[model samples]
Target: MKATLPRWADLALIPAINLLLAFFFAGLVVLFIGEDPIRAVRILITGSLGSSYGIGFTLYYATTFVFTGLAVAIAFHASLFNIGGEGQAALGGIGVTLVCLTLDHTHWLLTLPLAILGAGLFGAAWAFVPGYLQAKRGSHVVITTIMFNFIASALVVYLLVNVLKVPGSMAPESRNFAAGAHLPFVHEMLAAVGIKVSRTPMNLTSLLALLAAFLTWALIWRTRLGYELRAFGFSEPAAVYAGIDPVRITIVVMLISGAMSGMMALNVVMGYQHRLVLDYVGGAGFVGIAVALMGRSHPVGVVLAAILFGILYQGGAELAFEMPSISREMIVVIQALVILFTGALENLTRVPVERMFARLGGGG
Candidate 1:
């Protein structure tokens, strides 16, 4: 009989494996520090779900992760590793901040789309530079994109510290954005329904992030452009033989990735901070790579993965505060372990070493 498995089985296995690895790695860290692993684990779980504020914080972090995760996933689908998400997101934040500070209108109806669009355009432009270089000059995108991240950081610092620095302000940030640029808080709206949340950060940006994921899923799985991009990703030579233009697809994919990064500004600019500031993206761009990998570059998986990261981030901070021995950096260790295990999963399943272990067990 031919062996078969349900599609859902395969889908469910990834998360199961990831969670197992995460716990095992975290447990090891706890052991090394001479702390009770179970207690640490319990603290992490309760801190994240024990209160309304904790849940709100989790979702708030998820908003940034989901947006940047989509950026990474989009590039992965096209077989292009666009590592310039940091720079792209920074530029996007700058774009929106400029518009928010300069625009005289206080109506969100006019400012919201414009702010998002400006950020998207800035991010697309930032990414297009590398795409053009890769397509025309045969430059390696990985190296160029990494360099661009440094350049973007320097550019933003200069703009914030020198050019856009608000007069008489002793900070390295911009002035508060116009009221119209702020995202609506869900908690405030919930008051009308008699559902009160104490000390929450939840906002409408989470809803936008979900909508972005759905749109990205439809684009990748149900559209012609997505088909061509995936075809190119699988095999560039084959794509060319099939009359697909690899160069154009490469540029287009980078633009889409950059645009997604640009949307990340919504989490900070519109969702939390009413103004753009230095380090607004807060390393979310780099974390997005882990999210994309954990999700296997699928849209739905990306959302789930983003949520997991968000939980770890918020929970780990709480753990650090409550336990004198534990450090918030443990979250980074956990993330690194997840990436290593997931990266090796495919190869581990095919290795002959595994077969020997299986044979030894079966002989018993």
Candidate 2:
């Protein structure tokens, strides 16, 4: 039977309830560790949102999650699990680095658009191989993409070691990008307009993240291709019966997903790092899978989920610092609980609420 739920309930209430449940269990863990859960919650809130300083870092982290979350969310809508965001994003950093080295002296305005194209093309090409194998050779996308991730890591390492590394530098990284390539910080932009804010890594890429979310929403809900994609996702046989080309849908979805994942480099490498570096993605791609699950594969939900995680990252740091007993591993466990409930155990809350609504004659 189809479980009928109101739009608001499915999109908002269920996730909220799941989040609370996660925190409730996390609180118990804190108590077990001999800390007051309430105080910990307060510290969590304050550390991420209490001051401009904290907020800056929080938003900086959120910006990357927004991109990776959207990447995973798009693939989810098409019933494709694109687990290679890590590799795609790494390749994107290579794209950005090459572009910055060659065109940074020209001006940021000129460099950004070309960099976007390069990142998108590289990422899409990487994804296209897996999609082709899935559509033509019957190779499973999950295995192929996962394999490609390891390959991408090796490729990047080799490039840094042999090709892009600065002369005589022991670090496995390139030299700093030129001044023109430096992205203006949020504080600097605000200060230009006479409003002061705390300095942070947060930069113009945050705006691009929002724009990408909007574009994703429009593409998924308002386009004919979206209909075909959803139909394909719902049932491959049905889609083929309806004259949708399965191969085309599969390849296109992966391409779009890979492009979004690749764009994450814009924030980390271009905006914050200012040069290529090893392991710069910092597992945001994996975090995106959790974000996509919690968000129900919707763009707006992805944004909110991204922010929630940003809080966990920024606030978790402060929690460990202010109350050293809590420890970093405890914070990670708390985060794991959130992911566990939101992704794996979502139906735990969903089924009960659905039954309640059914009994009340409030749903179809």
Best by TM-score: 2
Per-model TM-score, in order, reads: 0.92, 0.97
Which parts of model 1 have CA positions greater than 4 angstroms off?
Answer: 1-10, 344-346, 349-364
**Weakest 10 consecutive residues, lDDT, candidate 2?**
355-364
Per-residue alpha-carbon lDDT of candidate 2 for residues 88-193, written as tens digits (9 for 90 to 100): 8888888888998898787888888888887787888888899889988989888999999999999999999999999999999988999767778899999999
Which residue pairs clash in candidate 2?
none
Q: How accurate is candidate 2 locally (lDDT)?
A: 0.90
Q: CA lDDT, every prediction?
A: 0.82, 0.90
Worst 10 residues of 1 by lDDT: 1-10
